[model samples]
Structures are given as C-alpha cells and as structure tokens.
Target: MHIHKLPDDVLHGILQHSCYFQYPDFYKWKRLLLLLSICKRWRHLAIPLVYNRVYLSYYDQSEDTSIVDDEPVETIKGAKTKTNLDLFVINNCASLARYADIRILFTSNAFKGLNQTIERMKSVLKTWSGIKTLSLTLVNDVYFVEHQVTAELYDAAQINQLTKELYNLIPGILNLRLKGSRLDRTNKHLYGKLAGYYNNQLKQLSSRHAIGLSDNIYFAQISKLDILLNSENGYKLSQMCTTSLVHLNIRGVPVNYRWASFKTNNDVEQIVFPHLKTFNISYLSSTPSVDRTGTELYNNGRLKIHFPVLTKLHLWSPLGHCELLASAIFPEKMDTFDVLGSSKTMQVLSNMRIPQVKKLYLNVASTTSNIRHATLQLINKILENSPGSKKNKLIIHEDSIQIDPAVIEWSQLTLLHIGAQINMDIALKVIAKLPNVDELTFYNFVAENIPEEAFALKNTSGCHNKLEALNSSITKLMLGHNELGHSKDAVITVIKYLSVRLESLSLFGAQVAFDTDMSEFVNDYSHIYPNLTNVTFRLLTAKVL
Candidate 1:
C-alpha cells in the first residue's frame, strides 16, 4: 500500500525553503522534473514551476528559406514562415498571463507575424500593472537588402518603429535595459529627443552616453554614475552636469587639454562642486613645467586644486604630479590620503600643508633630495601644527627619507616607520635619540649587517620615557624580511630581549629554517613578545606545527 503524497502547496514550501532561486539553472527544474517523472502528484507542481520563466518569443518560427530561380533569401517573398515563441505565448495567452510571470522577446523580421506578437502582449502588460519587474527587449538582426537591378539597400526604420511603439506603451517600468541596434543616426536633433525622454523618467537610470546621453542625465536620484570623457568634450560635459555626483570614475580625460581656460567669466562666476567625495583620475599625460619657480608656485601649481571634503584621491601617475595634486588639493578636512606609486611620493607629502590628515600612506620606490626635503618639511609642519593633536598618523615606505638622529628627538613624532632591518646599532641609536617615538616599524634590511649587539647594546639599555613608554604605549611594530636561517637559535634569543610593549608585527619575507625546533621558540617568544597578532611570510613555504 502506497502512502498519501504531500499537497502542491506543501511541496512548493519545501522547495522554497531550500533556496531554489539561487541555483535556478541547475536544481529548480531538474529536481522538480525528476520528482514529477516518478509520480503524477509531483509532476503537477513541477511543470508549472518550470513554465514560470517561459520566453514568449521562443515559440516564433525560424525564418528559413531556400530561394528558387536565383531569388535572394531574406526577401519578403522568399522568407521561410516558421512558428515563433510569440505565437505560442499568444495561443496560451490567458493561461500564461494568469501565471503572473511571462517574458516576451521580439525578432527583426517585421513580416513574420511580429505585429500579432505585440497584440497578444497588450493584455498581459495591462493586467500585470502590479508586476514587481518587467523587462522588454527588442533585438534585431542587421540584414542588407540586395536586388538584381539596384545597389545594396538596408531598411532599419521598420525595426526602430516597433521599438518606439513598445517603449511608449509601457507606463511604469522599474528596470529597463534597451540595446537599440541601429540607433546611431547622422541627424543632430535625435539626441535632444532621447535626452528629454530620459530626464522626465522617475525610475533610477543608467545609459551609455556615446549618443549624447551623459550630458543630459538630470535624474533626481543617481547613486552610482559612470561617464566616459574624451579630449574633445571633457570640460564642456563636466561644466554642464556633475553638481550632485557622489562616486565618479574619470578615465581618458586628455592630459594636454586646458581646463584653466574655462576659468574665464564668460559664463557662471562661481566654480561649482556642491557635493563630491571620491574622485579618481587614473590616466593623466599632463606634465606642467617646474622651471616657472617662486614661493608656492610649485605648491600652488601642484597642491592648489579644489577638493573641499575629499578624503581619498587616487591619481595614477609619477610622483611629481601626485605631489602637486596632494599639495594643492590637501583639504584641511581630509583624513586618509593614500599615494600608491612606482617610487615614494616624499616630495608630494613634504610640500603639502595637511593640518587635519589623520592617516597617510606613501608607497613609492625611488626618492630625491627635493622630495626628501619636501617630506621632512611636511612632517615638521604637521608636528608643528598638530602639537597637542592625538589623531594624526603617518606611514612612510622603506628608504624613503634620511632620518637625522637629532630631528627625531626634537619633534613630536609618536609613530615612526623604519623600513630597515633592525640592527642593534641603529635600534640603539634610534631608541636612544628619539624620546618621543612610541611606535617603530623595522623594515626588511640585510640581517647580516645587523651587528651582533643589536638588542644587547649596553651604551643605552634604557632611554627616555618615550623609549621606556614604548613597551606600554606603542601599538604597532612591523618587522621586515630579516631571516634567521641556519641560526634560528640566535634569532629566538634576540626576540627574547625585545621590549614587551610591541602590539602588531608584519613579517614580510623572512623565513625560519626548517630543521630548527620552533616549539620552544614559539613559547618563549609568545611570552616575551606579548600582543603579537599578524605574522606574515611573503614567499616562504613551510608548514607551521
């Protein structure tokens, strides 16, 4: 005797609970079909679920024809008449419409009962006003018409008419994606017409601006907007819109182009940027000459750009321009200014006057005296300006500047990034001299050069309150790639002598030898080097037991 099967509603609940929508392509229909094929009870529920996403255009006949007597195929007289998805949707119009979700797609062939397809969709489109989503796509195959007596001719107007009619019929569409195949026309008024239509729409909008759509988006709410700019129209388009834009990606803004010319008073007197947070200019080819020299000439030319509330600015170029932008656009309101470069932006950081900068990153490979001097001056200014401030922070890359032992002692530097292998000599010298240096980052330097007495330097085992305060106040300590290869014991012994106030450690590319006993080292080091969280190995492959 067979047990009674569950009802259709119960089966749907079971499927829905299992997150059937997530893996729609695989499980939605597969499981349903498999279960239904086993017995009639499951089939009834499975078939309807499978038919929910039916493509109305799929039933439309494939227009295939074998022209006779050298007659060209695709001609109205010679075209093959095939059943289309539209026809199938129309035949079962009432039943399919009642199911709530019906997708209709149209083909390029206007003669193949295409009008009949649109006629069938009117009821469904009208009745389903409460439909959560509606997507209408008009895809047309580009075909060139050729006759024996005349030159090649193509009729694209027919396809355009159908699309225009369908667009006008839909009153309230939440989500719309239109790929108008042959929308590009030589006529000038066409773009203005399209822009007017888009500006009046209430729904959220995004469209390709090549056909002059970028200059016309006046939508009330545009959270994410992306626009492409060329040398020809970058300034004009920018001057028109971009008042209330939040997130912007400005790519291909011609480097040699002149924006200063727009500084003229031929138009609005006030330079307008009411609200703009994130501004990223990736590609720049502009290289303003440095020879035109004076006080803040370099500063004004570079650092004097306008960004009232800009927190993050990513300029992908050499250090010179970066320095210029940072110094010019160094808003007193900015907190995090990250400079990622091929060489360090020491000069950029140095020349700029950033009084309110809390966190700073300078990632570059090469450095010069001008840049170094600029960096030193920048740091001096920050310390001078923010004497009693607690929130300001600085992080400089390896070998970016020459740190005079005296300068570190005189300034109010709480955090220091020394991207060099911690030598007993330098550590003794730095710790002894810098009374205010609380946090220190020892970057990867040649460990072989670190004199054996790095941690055991007796000239100054104990220094000022700041050096003594390091064990308590210091929060981060980054240890560069300085390995203790064959002599793991020596490395372990060295760490045992390190100050206890160290909080975080970043070991970039240092490897501990495989044959050594790490258990004793781990236990001893963990106890001595308390508050260690991140232990990273850059290019080492060894399982840690």
Candidate 2:
C-alpha cells in the first residue's frame, strides 16, 4: 500500500521509519523525490517535511562558499537555479536529527556565489518556502558545510554580525539554541549579548548566567532550558517561564530550587509541567542531596509533577552512588528511560518496577564481590522487567565482575560489550556466558597471551571453552582502540580467534594494525576466516607512534 494512504500518524511514522525526509544521502530521499514528481498528495505532505529544515554545511571554505549538493541531481524553487545555490541541498550525514528536530544549521558562512555571497543568500531565502522556524543548536564552535566540518570560535562583534545577517536574511522566526560555546572563559559579554540579542525567538537555551534576574533580561521565552553552571539566579530563571517549558536539564546536584524545583504555597493540584517531553538530570554526588522538607513532601505525594509527553529521561551519576526518589507520574510509553550510576543506581535499577525502556545502558565498575552480585542482579531484573527483550539493546560494563552462569539467566542476553580489555580473559568469560550475541565490538585490547583460539573448534578442556562462545552467533566484529605504537600481533591474535566465524571486520580509533595493508593481511589470513567478506580500517601515521 502507498504510505500516504495511511492515517496522518501512521503515514508520518512510515516516512519517519524510512527516514524519507532525512538528509537523503545515505537515506531514502530519492524515493521521496520520486513521490514528489509523481504523487501530488505525497508531495503535499513531503514538501513540508522534506524542506522543513535545511542543514547547509560548508566545511572547507565558509567564505567563498556557494554550497552545492554533491547528490540529488535536481534543484529546488529556482534557488538552485542561481550559481551559488541553484540546488539548495547538500548530502552528508555527520549526524542524524530525529523526527521532531526541524533545524536548518546556517550560521557564520552565508551562501554566496563565487562573486557576491550576501545578495545570493537573500535571493535564496526569498525563494525557499515552508520553512516557518529556523532553529539552530550551537553546541561548541563547530559549523558543518559540505563534506567537512570546521571549528573556529567567534567573538562578540562577530556573533552580533552573524545574528544580524541571519535575522535580516530569513523572513521567518529565528530560534537560536546556545547549547555550548567556544567563547573564551574570560570573555563574559559574548554569551550574554548573543543570547540577549535574539531572546524573543529563543526556544531552548543552555546558559550559566543569572538569567531572568534584575541585572539582565535574558529570558527569551525558552521552553527547553539547560542549566550548565550553577548560577545564583537559577531559581528565578526556572520559575520565570514555567508555563511554556517542554524540557529541563539540571547538570549538578539536584538539591535547591535550581533543580526542577516546582514548589508553591502548599498547592496539591499544582502540576509543574503539564506538557514536558523529557527531563535529563545528572549529579556529581554519590549521595544525592535532598533536604528534610523535600523528602517529607515527596513521601506524602503532595509535590505534583506530571510528564504527559515525555519520551526520554536520562539521569546518570557517574561520580558516585544514586537513588531516585518516589517520583511523580509518567506516561505508559517512554522511548528511553535511563537512570545510571555507580552502586545505588544499580540497586534502584534492580528493585524498581521498571518501565519499557527502548535502550538500556548499565555501567557497573567495582572490584568487590557484593557489588558484582548486585550488578548481576540488576542485569537479571532488566531482562525480566523489559518487554520485547530483543528490541531492548542492553549494555553493561562488567570490568571485574565474573558472570557465574548457573546463578543467573545469562542465556537471555543477546549482545554484550563489557568495558574492559576486550582480549582479556574476563571479557571473554562474560561473553562466553552470553552465547546469543550476534555482533561484537572490542576496544583497548592487551597483547597478552591471547590464545590462538578462544574456544577450541574441537571442544578443549580449560579457559578455551569460554573464549569463543560467540563463534556461532557473532557474524560482525569491530575492533577499536588504537595501540598505535604496539605490534600488529594483538590485532592478528584476536582476529585469528574469531577468524572462522566472523563474516565482516572493521577497525576504528586511528590504528590500523600498525598501518599494515589490511587487504594483504586479509588475503594472507584468507585460509582461516574463509567466511570473512568485508574488512575496513583507518590507518594512522608514524607521528602518532
């Protein structure tokens, strides 16, 4: 059936699932282009979704850059007719924007022709249609254009000029997101001035300044707020626009009013955020600082907090232990719900009536046996609580823990990547415990006494039995971690272990078997891994040695 014939939600889901409106290169845009040519109804739906946002990245030369699409052999709205931007789309996927992100990253560099850029930019902006909101997420000093992405920090004056240029060119509303900055730490006015310049259209902001205070009127009606640095005026800023907030991220210890604190004068019906989508919070403490009053209020269910549209809630406490209090209400369906930490996080994960998490990551690092037991308990709990167990991609860091298969249902595990020396005995022992993992990626491997074969092809007697437990299940293997100065024997040894079963192998992290030609290496080892079809790598230079 034609996807457009489905209901709005269903059809939208199909387009999203197929990534029709995605960057098109490394995507299904050609089908979208075909639909645009033939299907009028499809065009009606797709035009809005396709050109909703334009990611024009000119990496090499931000100046003298009349951006051209390396793919999509057609032009749009005569904007592509002009020399500078006769075709207003570029094709490369440095990152992928999800369904809701209608962001067109056009900053610093204007789309000027080989001769005059500013006039060409205005002309393109004038012709381009259906782009109602131009949102930018400026995280760090990086801007993407064409095949290359470069980083060069800008000062106050430069920022002001760029803002003015964009504001002047595009007729639609401009919403800027200051996620991170490349501004010098000493330079104070740049963030404030840039934020304050277009505060009206700002929807999401990550700021450390004392916004919404008497000193500065830096509130741009932002709905998603990230408090990066703990400012003194954080309390007032969070309280300023409680009505329109869709997301709030608190990056420090959630103790005071700076931490999603929606309290009133004893109002039981005061639901803080009626339509918040996500709430990501982290703490730098093992013991989360909750005062006496806060605990008392939460215990009685007096503090009302509601998330009707929440899809994700990622809270990680890497520094120390963490414990989530009896929180408020959440919808039945959540895309990703992660609450990760050292020890306490594991306890919470194991005991709680867990939600249907789409992606679960567990990092348990402890040398003690009790913690290891708790880690295994958490793993078992995760498998039991989560629905559609296969779709749930579970990752746990068991650096020191030994998985005693008899105690737990280790057979339920399908994919395991323990954060430790990949070639070491512990990692193999754990992988050996989970016999169903179909794919594996190992990094930072030690060139110790790696067995010629992890598990004997004919069933051997010692640790060999545990090493290649994934031989039948594992088809794809990615070996990362650059031991650039080390010998290629590490790579050869590990590959030799899985050589019989592996169909594809990829090397990343700047070391390609000490710069040895992988084609020749594969050919030389052709007799071993007869099924190996593809091999890829990134060869590093001798300077890195």
Candidate 3:
C-alpha cells in the first residue's frame, strides 16, 4: 500500500519521525517541502511537524542569478525580491501560528536598509503569538563594511523595541537566546526594560556577545543561564539575583586571579547561591601567569562564595585556571566531575580529592606526547584514589594510555568508553583487565606497530588467548570513527576473541567500499554471537549493490 493510504496515526508518526525542524538547515527544509508536495494527506500530516520550529535567515540569492543582458541590472532589486527571509515566513507559513520555536538570523553584509529590516522582523514576531522559545542572531562581518553603512551594526533602540514587542506579543515565552549583536554598556536601559518583563516568566536565558547587563536584574524562575563572557560587559556573579537557578554555564571569560576576588567585599562577607546544583566554566584565557607557590590560595583565600547544594561541576579551562578555581570553589559533595582540557588540567585534577565523585569524564587533550603521558599519570592516580564502595563509570576521550593491570581496580568499573586512537595491543590488554565492564565503546581503533601474527587465529600462546578468556560481563559493543574500514581485521579478531555474550552492536562512521558487502559480513558474524539481536550502523557509506 502507498504511504498516504496508511491510517492517520501511522502517517502522523512517520511525518513526526522524518521532520527536521529542530535542525535548521536549508536542505532539510527542501526535503520537508518535497515530502509535503507528495499528496494532500501527506501535506496535512506533515504541516504541523514542518512548522513546529521555524528558522528565518537572510539567504544571499545574488550568486544564484546570472546577468543575461550587457546592461547591468541592480543587484538590490534581486536581493529584495529573492533573499527576503521575513517575507517567506509570513507569506508561506504564517497560518501555523502555534510554532513552538522561532529563530531569526541576520547576516551583517546581506540585508539592505536596517530600519526596514527591523520593521519586517517586528512584523514577523507579532504574527507568531504562541512561540515558547525565540532566538535572535546578528552575524557580524569579519571586516568593516565600507560602501553601505546600514548593515554594519544593529541600533540599540531598534533592538530594544523589537524585544519589547516580542514580550508583549508572546508573554508565555519560557526560553530566550540572543547572539552576535553588539550591545555594550549603552544597552543598560534595554536590560532594565527586559528585567521588568522577563523576571517572572522566563525559565532559561542564553546570550553571546549581546545584551550586556550593567545593572542588577532578578530572574524569578530562571533555572539555566548560559552567557559568553566578554571583558567589557560580562555579568558579574555577585550582580545576579536568582533563587531558583540550578544550572549555570559561563564561557569565554578571561581567567585571572581577580575572578576569585569578585566575591570579596569589605561590607559583604559571603555571596551565596542557595539552590545552584550544576556550574560549568570554560574557554579561559591562558596569557596570565598564576602563582603556584602560595599555600593560602588553596583555601579559597578571602573570597567567600558558597554553592550550598552544588553537585555536578564541569571545568574546561587551562590547567592553572582549573586548579585555581577548584581550590576556591570545589564543593564537598560532587556527584559528577567532567574535566576537559589539556594535560595541565589533568595533572592538577590527579592530586585533588573528591571521594564523592561517582561518574568521572576525563576529556583530556592528547595531541602532544607530553599531554598523553600526563593523561596516563592522571588515570593511574584516579584509580588509586577511587572509593571502594560505589561502582564508577569512566569516559576517556582523545588519548589512550597504557593500562597497568596491577594498579587498576577492574571490578569497580561498570561502563568504559574509549573514544581515542590507541594501539590494538593496549586495547586488548585493557579489555582483558576490565572483567566487569558491561558496555564498551572503541573509537578510531589503531593497529600500528603490531605484527600480523598478533591477530592471527593460529597464535594460541600470545595475548589473544587472554582476550579469548576474558570475562563474560560485557553485553554491548560500539565501534566509532572513520578509520573502521582499515581496522576491520583487528575489529574482527577482537570480536572473535572476546567471549562476552554480546547483546547489541553499533557501528558509527564506518566506511564501506564498493567491493565490501556489509550485509554478508553481518550475516557471517551473527553465528558467532548467538545473543546479538540489535545491530545498527550510523553514517555508513557504500556503493549501491
């Protein structure tokens, strides 16, 4: 039977599954439009899915057109007629007023007549009354525009007017994001107006290089706040007033010792975030030198900031900055700690004590030899200091360290994800050690500097035997990255030796050549794994058979 002849429920499910509204891409939208053009029933089922989230952007159509006559026609006329995103949204999809999310993007050099563009944006916002989330991005040019000055900057007053109109039109908006617009201290009046309107209803706020807050603003129900910190107008932690905030992410903030001093005041003793639970800080500057000899630095010094209920902490900063922040704000009871950076951060994390940490993600930068060595050292220290009661799950990315079987407590590990390029021999040895791992993931399996005999089935006396005798607790295996085609022999050997009763297998980014038949390979391997029932491939490429 044809797809359109199916039941309403089935058709609706198919349309929902195929819609790409969440991912704002031109090709995806074209595909959705094609699907809608199939038939009336398909259009009826797919309309809501396609209009659930709308992204409007200024698309330059000048390159798509060719000049046929010797006399030059004005490009502005074509731009207005063909590249208008606001007109497309209002003319084509304005009937779907219940769109949950709306994103408006303006390229710095694309639009003409700034005031007209703003008016068009205001009209678009007024047309959509049921939007729960709104995102505005004004992309800046790499160099200054010389010819037409209208596209260089967005007027502060115009932006404020647009924001006020949005708030008045969509009072129930729960999430708001503003990005790439230049608003410095001059925009304090805008913030004052927004603070009054969004204080009670907005639940999440994220901004990048836009809307600098010069005065204190209170968010009554705001729980998650993400901001890209700039030197001029970045919000100070002490200036924010919120009682329900639980997740806070601050990025692009220059790291200096003075950040710890932000909390120190002669009048106020301590600034407290009573209910915050998750704090993430990243993209710290590395130009400043830190004093590592001072013993008082580790005790948080005179800085008095308290995260009374903080449990999950993620730090993506330079080694010195991570150490400095951890020493000052390290909570007593952290449930999950994700340390992502170079070996400098790892070296500092190794010595730190967090006995309450149950789930640790070490995303260390291992591009250099020195960083790889430090990562290995950090892993050893983590295993050494791990508590014996709680079973820990570890995720290692970007580097593979040699595992010393004698020092690691293999039984304590529950899930291990190795998303890195590692020697095949080392991977086999590590798997043999982790007798209790239930799930294992390997990314970019590297088999360099290994003899062919190592993977040969005839070699019964080598480490292959240990791999064959490894424990049977593992049930899931995932292979990832683009190097899978080259490492097929090593992957097959590992699968043949591993005695675990596998239940699921996933291959991601596996490159299949025209000569290779993935179905036949799967059929051949299925007999070896009697319990394997679910097998999936993501981003698999091959010539048509």
Per-model TM-score versus the true fold: 0.49, 0.54, 0.62
Q: Give one digit per residue, the lDDT tens place, for model 3 in 408-466.
A: 55555667777667555666667667777777776655545454544544343322332
The residue ranges of model 1 lying beyond 4 angstroms of the native Cα positions read: 1-242, 249-270, 278-317, 322-374, 386-424, 427-443, 449-476, 482-517, 524-545
Among all candidates shown, the one with the greatest TM-score = 3
- Candidate 1, residues 166-225: lDDT per residue as tens digits? 445443334333222233221112222333344444242223332333444454433334
Candidate 2 C-alpha lDDT tens digits along 45-105: 5554554344432222322244556743223322232221333434221112222121122
Q: In each prediction, how many residue pairs overlap at the backbone (N, C-alpha, C within less than 3 A)?
A: 25, 10, 0
Q: State candidate 1's TM-score.
A: 0.49
Winning model by lDDT:
3
After TM-score superposition, the amount by which residue 391's alpha carbon in candidate 3 deviates from its true location, in angstroms, is 6.6
* Candidate 3 structure lDDT: 0.54
Q: Is candidate 1 or candidate 3 better by lDDT?
A: 3
User: Given candidate 1, what's the lDDT at residue 488?
Assistant: 49
